[model samples]
Target: MVVLVLTACPAGLRGHLTRWLLEVSPGVFVGQISARVRDLMWARVLELSKDGRAIMVFHADTEQGLAFRVHRHDWQVVDVDGLSLMLRPHEVGGQSELRPGWSSVARARRARRRK
Candidate 1:
């Protein structure tokens, strides 16, 4: 089974994918197909999704039992200790940092760092 999530893509691209996959939701597609076909579909997306982002998740014989790949996305997919995590893009000017938590101590530390 393959699941594909697309953002900001052209309608034509979505139409192409709908041929092989079901458009379960807007910009979301899912279906069961061979790996080769999946690759071809992604390649077509790459060619057509000029200003879009896409992510493909499929079953694989990996430690996590599944694997995912992202394309043209702002958020980054990172692998750490056999786990997959998503990291959002850092804010401009680095205003607020994602620290341990919003404890009083954490707030105080941020204030101290500014000084």
Candidate 2:
């Protein structure tokens, strides 16, 4: 199995980037993504550099798994394979530190809203 870390500048871009990644690679991918939709915007801004372009990063492999760093600016691909091992969630200590920033409070609020 392979693990990846996906991040976006703003919450809106995160969704688009996630969708793009899912559209590109279907079943081989699994992760969490969060973004806000205003019901008007449909695309994401993937800035590779300071030049303003969308960038996506992931890890891929056939037997040993591969790491990829993509620069959406000029469409550059850098492969870093056999560099490191993918860390499992359980191995990372526990769920105590899982909540970052305001996520925990936000989750509680969302739960209340749902109820």
Tell me each candidate's TM-score: 0.79, 0.25
Q: Which model scores highest in TM-score?
A: 1
Error of 1 at 50 (Å): 0.7
Question: In model 2, where is the ten-residue run with the lowest total lDDT?
Answer: 35-44
What overall lDDT, based on C-alpha atoms, would model 2 receive against the true structure? Answer: 0.38
Q: Model 1 Cα displacement at 30 (Å)?
A: 0.6
> Candidate 1 clashing pairs?
none
* Number of clashes recorded per candidate: 0, 6
Model 2 alpha-carbon miss at residue 104, Å:
36
- Could you tell me the TM-score of candidate 1? 0.79
Candidates in order have lDDT scores of: 0.88, 0.38
lDDT of 1 by residue, 1-115 (tens): 9999999999999999999999999999999999899889889988999999999998888788788889988678898998877878776366655555579998888889989
- Can you give the lDDT of residue 110 in candidate 2? 76
